[model samples]
Target: MVLDDLGSSLRGTLKKIANAVHVDSKLIKEVVRDIQRALLQADVNVKLVLDLSKKIEKRALQEKPPAGMSNREHVIHIVYDELVNILGGSRELPIKKQIIMMTGLYGQGKTTSCGKIATYFKKKGLRPALIAGDVHRPAAYEQLKQIAEQVKVPFYGDNKEKNAVKVVKDGLNKFKRSSDVIIVDTSGRHKLEDDLIQEMKDIFKATKPDEKLLVIDAAVGQQAGSQAKAFNDTVNITGIVLTKMDGTAKGGGALSAAAEVGAPIVFIGTGEHAGDFEKFDPARFISRLLGMGDIKSLLEKAEESMKGKDAEKTARRLMSGKFTLHDMYDQMDMLSGMGPLSKVAEMLPGGFSGKIKDIDMDDTQNKLQRFRVIMNSMTDEEMNDPSIIRASRVKRIAHGAGVENRNVKELLKYYNMTKRMMKGLSGNRKMRKNLMKQLQFGK
Candidate 1:
C-alpha cells in the first residue's frame, strides 16, 4: 500500500495526455510539470523527480510513434517504463544458506520483520532460525522466542548474556548446521550515535552476514532515507523491509528513500502476524500506486493467505454473480487471511481507499463474528436464499444469534445492498470494460 498517492496523482496527469491526440510542446511541458509536482509532494527527491521528468519530456517529443501505436500510447508506455526504472526494476533478495542481519532504529518493527522473513523462507522449503542479538531491549529476546514458537522455527538468544556480538557469533555456529537461513535481530537506538554504530559494526564483523537488511517504519516518511543512510554508513544494506505499510499513508516516503539509496525493497509487512508478509512485486506495486486494481496480485495474496478450493470456489461465485451472504461470510474469512481491510482496499481501483477513510475498517473482525452468529441462526433455506426472511423470521433469528432484531435487520439490509450492487455491476458491460482498461493502463 506504499506509494498509494502516486497512482491517483499520476493518473490525473496522464489523463490530460490521453485526452489529446497530438503531442505538442505545451502539452509535454504541462505533463512534466504535473509529474514533478506529484512526485515532490509525495516526498520524492527533487533531483530525481526533475531528472525523470526531463527524460519523459524529451522522449515524448523526440520518439517516433511505432506502427499501429497511437501517439498517446507511445507516450504512456515511455512514462511507465521511465517510472519503473526510477522505482528500480524488479529485484529479489539473494536467497542462500547464509546469515542475514536485520538492523534499524528502535520501534521500526525489526523484531517482527525477522520472524516474518524467517516464515517466508520456511514456506520456500528452507529451515530458518532466529537469532535475537537485541540485548538492549528488555523483552526483545522473549518476543523473538514467542515469534519463533508461532512460526515453528528455531531461536537462539540469552537474556543473561550482555555481549550482543558474542551472542550473534554463538547463534550462528549453533544454528548453522540445522538452519538454512540464520536471521540475527540486532539492537537499535532511539537516534544514531557512536556507540550504536560501533556495536552494529562489531556484530557485522562477528557474523559476517551474507545479507544485511534494514527494517524501516513506513510511517517515518522522509526520514527513512536518512535512516537508511545512517545504518548503511556502519553496515552494508543489501535490501530493505518496509514495515507497517498496511497502516501508513506515508509509506510512499519509504519508497522514495529506497529509490534514493538504490536499495530494492524485498519485503513488506502488511500486519502483525508472521504470515502477513509478502514479496515485493514491481508491476503489481505500480498498479496499486496508480489506483488501478492489481487483481492478479490480490488473487495471489488471497490464495497465499487462504487454502484449499474454497478461494477458487468463491472466485467462481463472485464472477458468476451467485454471491450470497454465506459467500460473503466465507469471503470475510478469506479476507482475514489476506491481512487488514485497509490494505485490501488500497489495491482497489479509482482510489476506493478514500471511501472507507472515515470508517473503522478494523472492526472487520468483530463485524464478521456478529454476522456469522446471525447467519448461523438462519434457516438452511434462508442462508441459501435470504429473500424469504420476513419480519417474524428476522426477530426469531435475532434471538437465536444473541443479538438485537435490529442487528439482524441491518445484516439483511447489508446483504441486500451487496446483492444489488453486484447485480448492477454484473449487468453493466461498459463498467466492466472500463475497469479492465483502467487496470491495464492505469487510466
Candidate 2:
C-alpha cells in the first residue's frame, strides 16, 4: 500500500465517523481535527491542509446529505473528493511515437525510473527504447543499458561521449525509426547547478522531447515543490514522476507540492521492483488511500498479470465443480504474479479490505507458500482427489514437505471448503453468469 501510515490514519478517522452515535457540528469538528492531524503528520503543506479541512468542514455543515446517503457518508465523500483535488488529477500520455526526456537531481531514482517507465509502455503494447543521456555519471550508461536489456528494448548510449546532448541526438536517430516511444534518461547533478541547467537546456534543444518529466523523491517532503519549480523553470517540465511513494510519510508533501506547481503527477514508482510503476490517477489513488478501492485499476492489474494463462479453462473447470489442488495452485500463482496481497487488498472496498488487513499478510503469504509445498508433496491421485489423503498419507506428505501433519490437514480443510464453495457457485445461474462476465471467462 502506498502511503500506508496516512491511509491507516485516515481510515481510523473515518471509522470514528462511521461509529458515531450522531452526526452533528461537534462530530464534524472532531473529524476535521483528526483529518488535520493525519494530513499534517503526512507532511502535507500547512496551508493546503487547512484549506482542505475548511472545505470539508463547510461542505459537511452547510450541505445536505443525498437521498441515499447519511450525514456521515456525505462527510466522508467530501473528504475523499477534496483529497483527490489536492493530489491533482491524472495526466494522460497517449501511446504513440514520441520522445520523453527525464530529468532530476542525482539520487532521485531518475535512471531507474527510465526503465520502469519503459516497462510501463511495453506492457501497454508499445515499443519503448531507452537512451542513456546522463554523461556526468560514469555508471549511468551501463545502468540504463542493463535496464534496457532487462526490459528487452533497444538502447543507445556512448559511454565515452562526454557531450550529453550529442549522445541523446545520436541515440534518438538510432532508435527513431524503430521505437514507438523513446525515453531519454538525462543527466543530473548534486544540486541545480549552472552546468546542469545548461546541459539540460542543450539536451532539451537537441531532442525536442514531447514530455519533459522531472522525477522527484517523495521523501523530499515540502522541499519537493522548490525542486519541481527549479526543474520546471529550467526545462518547462511537462509532468512529474514521483519515486519512492511506497511507505513514505512525506509522499503527501511531494504529491501536493508537485500539484501546486501545476505539473500533473503522471506516474509514481511505488517500490524497488521494475513492475512497481503505475499511472498516477488522483481519484483512484485517493480511493485506495481511503480504503474505497479502485476496482478499475484492480481489474486492469488482473488482466495484465493473468495474460497467457488459461483463465477460460480454469473458469470452465470451476463451473463444472472439478476444482482440484492443481487448479488452486494455478489460481494462487496468478494472484502472486499480480503483486503482493497487501497491495491487492488496498484496492478492495473499505468494508472488505479492512477485514483482510487484520490478518497478518506475511503469515498468509507464508501459509500460501506452505500450502503449495504440501501440494507438491502429494501424488497426482491425492492432488486430483484429496479424499484419498488419509492419516498415514498426511503424515508421509508432511514429512516430505518438512511440516507438521496438521499443516497438511489444514491445507486439505481449506481445499475442501474452496471446492464446496465452487460447487455452490457452479449451481447458481445468476451468480455464475455474473462471475463469467466479471472474469470474462470462456469469451
Candidate 3:
C-alpha cells in the first residue's frame, strides 16, 4: 500500500473543493496546494508533482465542462486524468517466445522475482524456464530450484558452475526447445561495483535477453531512483518489477523512480508466494492511490491469484449474496494465493482505511495462520455444514488445529453470523445495490 496516504488526503482536499459553488482563483489555488502537499508527502517526484498540478490547474480553469457534468465532476475527472498520466499508462508485458533478463542489487529479491516472473508467464499458457545465472550467492541456485518446483516451471542452474555467463549460455541452448520464455536470473552486487556490473554486461551479451527488468525493493524509498540510474547505466532496463510492495510505505518512491527513469512497472510482488505477483495496472493503481474505487483491478488480482473456474464461481456467489461459511472457506483458499489479508485489503477499491473504518478486521498474520489451521482441521462435511460441530467435535477439532476449543467455536460463530447477515442483506434490493456499488466502486 505505497502512497496510501495520498488517496484519503486528496479526497479530503477534493471534498473541500466540492463544497464550493464556483471554481474561482482561491479555490484553484487551494486545490493545487492540497495536491502538492499530498504528492510530496507520498514521496512523488517534486517536478512531476509541479507539472501535474499545473496541468490540472490549466484544465480546470480553462477547459469547458462537458454537458450535464457538474463543475465538481469536471474537476475530479481532470485530476484523475492527470494523476493517471503521471503514473504512466497501461503497458503489458510481451508474451512472445523470448528471453527476459532480471537485474538488480543483491538482496533486492531478484532471485525470487525471477521465479515469480516465470510463473506469471506460465500462467499465461507459455512454458517458461528459469536459468539461475546468479552464482554469487551459494543458495541462489537452490532457491531458484525450490521456487521453480513450487511454481512448477522448468529450471536450469548448476551450483558447481562458478561462471554465470557459461551457465546461462549453456542453459539457453539446453532449454531452447522446451521453453518459450527463458528468464535469466543474473547475479547482483550488494553495492554498485564495477566487477558486478561488468558481469551483468557479460551475461547480457551471452544471453541476449529480449527484456531486461530491474527488480527493486519498494522499501528502498528515495534510493530507488539512484539504484535504477546505476543499473540503467550498466544494462538497458526495459521495465521494472517492484518487489515487497505489501510491506513498504515507500512503494510510491520506487514507482516514482520507475517513472523518472522512463521504465514502466511490469509486475509487482505483494507477497512471498510464487502466485502473489500481479501485473501493474495504471488506472486501477491511480484509483487506489486517489482513494477512488479500483474494483476492476481488485477483481483481476483475485482472479490471477485464484485461477480457473473456482475463482469465477466464488466471485459470482459474492455478487449474488450467496456467501456462506463454505463460500468463505473457498474465498479464504483463494486469498491464500493472493497474499496476506492486510495486503489484499489495501488493494481493494477504497483501500484499507475506508474498508476497515467500522469493523475491527483482525489482520494479524498470526490470526490468519490460526484461521488456516482451523480450516484444515475441519472435515469436508464440517466445512460445508458447521452446525454439525457439537461441543465434543469442537474440542477435537481445536486439538487438531492446535488452538483452544473456544477459538474453534468462535470461528463457527463468526461464520454463522456472517451467513445470517448476508442472508438478511440479500433480501433487500436497495441494500444489495448499495453494497454492490460500494464493493465495485468504493462509492
lDDT of each: 0.75, 0.81, 0.75
Off by over 4 Å in 3: 17-23, 291-443
Residue range with the least summed lDDT across 10 consecutive positions in model 3: 339-348
Model 2's TM-score against the true structure: 0.66
* Ten-residue stretch with the least lDDT total in model 1: 434-443
lDDT by residue for model 2 (393-416), tens: 999999999999999998887667
lDDT for model 3 comes to 0.75
RMSD to truth, every model: 23.6, 23.2, 24.0
TM-score of 1: 0.61
**Candidate order (TM-score):** 2, 3, 1
Residue by residue across 337-434, what tens digits does model 1's lDDT show? 54323442444444444544434467656766788789978887898899899999988999999999888887776566445544554566665445
Best by TM-score: 2
lDDT of 3 by residue, 204-249 (tens): 8888888999999988866788888877877878888889988776
Q: Give residue 93's lDDT in candidate 2 (0 to 100).
A: 83
Give the lDDT of residue 244 in candidate 2: 96
Give the RMSD in angstroms, all C-alphas superposed, for model 3.
24.0
Clashing pairs in 3: none
